[model samples]
Target: MLKSLLSDKPGARPLVEAIRACRWHLLAAAGFSALVNILYLAPTLYMMQVYDRVVPTGGIITLVLVTIVVFLALGTLAGLDVIRTRLLVRAGLRLDQQLAGRTLGRAMGSHETSARAGQVMREFDQVRSAIGGQGALAILDAPWTPIYLLFCFLLHPLLGLLTLVGALMLFGLAVLNERSTKSRLLKAHEASARAYAAQEQVSTRSEVVRALGMRRGLVARQLTARAEATGAQSEAQFTGGRYSGAIKFLRLMLQSLALGLGAYLAVQQQISAGAIIAASVLLSRAVQPIEQLVGAWPGLVQARAAWKSLTDLYEATGDQDEAHTLLPAPAGRLDLQEVSVRMSDGDTPQLKQVSFSLEPGQMLGVIGPSGSGKTTLARVVAGAYRPQLGAVRLDGSEYGQWDPERLARHIGYLPQDSVLFAGTVKDNISRFEGAADPAADQGAIDLRAVTAAKAAEVHDLIQSLPQGYDTPIGPGGRGLSAGQMQRVALARALYGSPRLLVLDEPNSHLDQDGETALMRALKRAAEAGAAIVIVAHRAGVLASADLLLVMNKGAVSRFGPRDQVLQALQGRGGPRIASVS
Candidate 1:
């Protein structure tokens, strides 16, 4: 069974490995469950002894001895139950430790929306909780239901038959409960997820919503989504509640019937009076697991759905450990050969057959009108997007050849959005890199970050902040002006003295001085042998461009020396070519 579960597939590997790590604990919990269930029979046996043997004979010593044994067994049973619960909880924690980082990493790095990321996280939590929750305990106890039924049979054939009928009824009710509530619960979950995503979206962009007078409208939409989700959930819960009440009523009725029928058998002299109590105890025990299972059915369903979702996501993302042997450091050289990218559902490629090369110390300017695939090209070059055709190489090594984290140190990309995370200025500039050792020299790390800030000419600006490099900034760099955020982001791109820099609209929010500082920083970076690609609309920003590539409708229309490309554009009466001079 273990061998069958431990699949060789990449997607299953993480979850399988997590389960393997916790196998011993799970096995121990199962073992404890067996011991605990066996001990549960102590009460039935004790009651039977007192009624059939001690009560009729009036032997006080016999009653005392039986009660002592039962007490010891019950105590042991309680201890084992505690151990079982702790073992399962440990297993759940271990599973989380194993997969949470990977899940969050995939969420952050993938192109999935924030809503999808949140949904995946909730799914992962569901699976983790199911491992240790009452649902798991109920599942473990379910198999031992037969133990009680066996005892019932040993007590009397008629009692065993009665218990079987009651068990089957409870089982039927559970099945009915599942059928009636499954779709409703599923719908509720999806609606809740959508509502959560909408709320998250609005919260993240609260500033925009308030400024645009969209607060009331967005809130109304969110409330509507929430109401629908609540309605579905309430209906599902109400249906489940009805079954729960019925199950409770049926269980009580069955126990009473067992007692009454036992009495009839005893009065007829068909079975001993002690057998009556034993039959009632056994019947209730037999159906107890079923009742608990029914109550925990929703959690089990969620867990099953979450497991499938996680597996699908893992499969879609492919292997996380794709790293090979560490290569030597990259030099400031980049090459793209016949690279192309197409949307999954689109017929037209976003970028088509584009090729380019840049040696150390060279700078390339990309100019294009809106929708010319400039951003896509920049992403492809930055190793953010893998081309479906051809390759992107840094220092003659394909992007795939290098570990992503290691390669990122050699490549700097300032995206069009220039979004900054909430962190200290130093941490932001340092890309959140930290020393593993608590006693490590944090000063050295900060020094390097400060140097990057200085390189980008943002050092003075940062120093002007309340705490200088230690100043905390909110998400999206809310503490800084737009130009300051861009400059700070530029410093981040310059950190580690990366071999290649890709800047998209780097000066979009900058004033004249900020633009001049940015241009100066780019020149210094180039002089220091960093190959750079700058995508921009401002021709002035491309003044020092060694080469110019003009893009037209996702294809390179012209690529040559800066002056030559400009002259061609001017001569052809193409989209107005602004002069750098």
Candidate 2:
């Protein structure tokens, strides 16, 4: 899963391009932060001088002017700091927006695992936060630290040594913290991912659990997983925080020791009082950046871990070797040449050396017993999965050669369990395409005509409530019966007027009247020159077909015109059935 998040680097281009995009704002913010730090440090050093020598020299007016200058400098620094912060924040927001746009666009088109997508999204958030928060401080303080250190070294070498030691110690502490917590951090992240997956599973299948009276069991399992994950995370965070606190306390103690030593040197007259005072001020300034570095250690570690996870996700499932563009409407002819599919676990093949062909405007009925791979065959034809050793072709051209988007335009597939989104019927039918009447485009299929065709055959028994086609359907079309939902799915597929239509178990929940209406619609579609494939177990639906294919153990056991196939099945003592009531 982690393998899918690893995207090919945009090379030096994206990095430099992103920087250039926000360069002006970054420069302004950095410049202002430097000015603020310099002004902030100058007043403290000057105050030490005034106390140690200026007042003693009796320069009252000069001292007053200098004090005023300090206040004005501080005010300017404070104002600039605010402006800089706002500017950097805006720049960060813009950068995040741009990166997120690119990421989302890639995500939509790439066939990555869901786990990998989640990891990518998590990493994106971490990067965004870093830029907006600690990242900004790191940028400002990192550059300023050297300049401030140089000033301290000039003022007093002893103070400079102390500041250097403190910075080193802080760095050592952060490194130690990272090393100790890295494993725990990774474990915590794994736990979180599991908990999220569990929660999603429970939410997505809530109805099934409730109906099966397993709600309590499902909830218990979810809560247990969540609690375990929470405990792991809390333990990791607590351990890291305790270690950080200890380091901070030790640093503070060393700071006090440094100040005391500097004061003692001044009293011995080994150093000027002004020098001691300035040294103390500089030591404080030096420790500030170190403190911030220590404080940001946890976030940095977590962000790195997230980034690694994202890279791993990308590596696992990012590559797609079969990158053919989908073709426009297939010639309404499909041929499966000795196609076979095996489970990823290397179990017995689900489909094996199955070969069949449907001519343009033909209707093929697929029939089989339970677990005989009828639905699987339908999905194969629909291009949901690639057959291991064979090929699916449209109009004698390999199906993979067609662009996915263009192929979708020509082929309409309805799964056994049709799902509907939460929206008005029109909205669900149009999906991302806005609700311009589906009937408007020249070649556009009319969804209403599809519905009318089904209704003419008497399939649409119940009119949609409240607003007809505009009525809002609950998620998954929960308010509708199974048969009603099936009809709606049929309407959607017909609305596209696709050249090739694949319907899996469309008659599963339909009553006699509904089945009649559906058969009429299928006949109408066939008459309109669309190739139709139906996967079914019922004889009524099968008898209406132009051809029948009987599947057994992943192979086509029998195939011919409907009458001949039925006659053969009857000769074997199969249930004698009628084609239509």
By lDDT, the best candidate is: 1
Model 1 clash pairs are none
Cα-based RMSD of the predictions, in order?
Answer: 2.5, 4.7
- In angstroms, how far off is 388's CA in candidate 2? 6.3
lDDT of 1 at 51: 90
Give the TM-scores of the predictions, in the order they appear: 0.93, 0.82
lDDT of candidate model 2 versus the reference: 0.70
Candidate 1, residues 1-581, lDDT tens digits: the string is 34643446786677788888888889899999999999999998898899999989999999999999999999999999999999999999998999998887775566333355567888889988999999889888889998899888887789989999999999999999999999888888778878887787788888899899998999899989999999998898999999999999999999999999999999999888889988998899889988998888777776776676677667656545664778888778899999999876578888999998999999999999999999999998988887889989998998888877889899989999888989898888988886324575788778889999999999999999999998999988888888889999999999989999999999999999999999999999999999999999998889999999988889998898998989888888876756886
lDDT of 2 by residue, 191-301 (tens): 777777667767766788888999888779878987877787777788778767976786677668667777887777766667666766666676676567556755665
Locate the minimum summed-lDDT window of 10 residues in model 1: 107-116
Compute the lDDT for candidate 1: 0.87
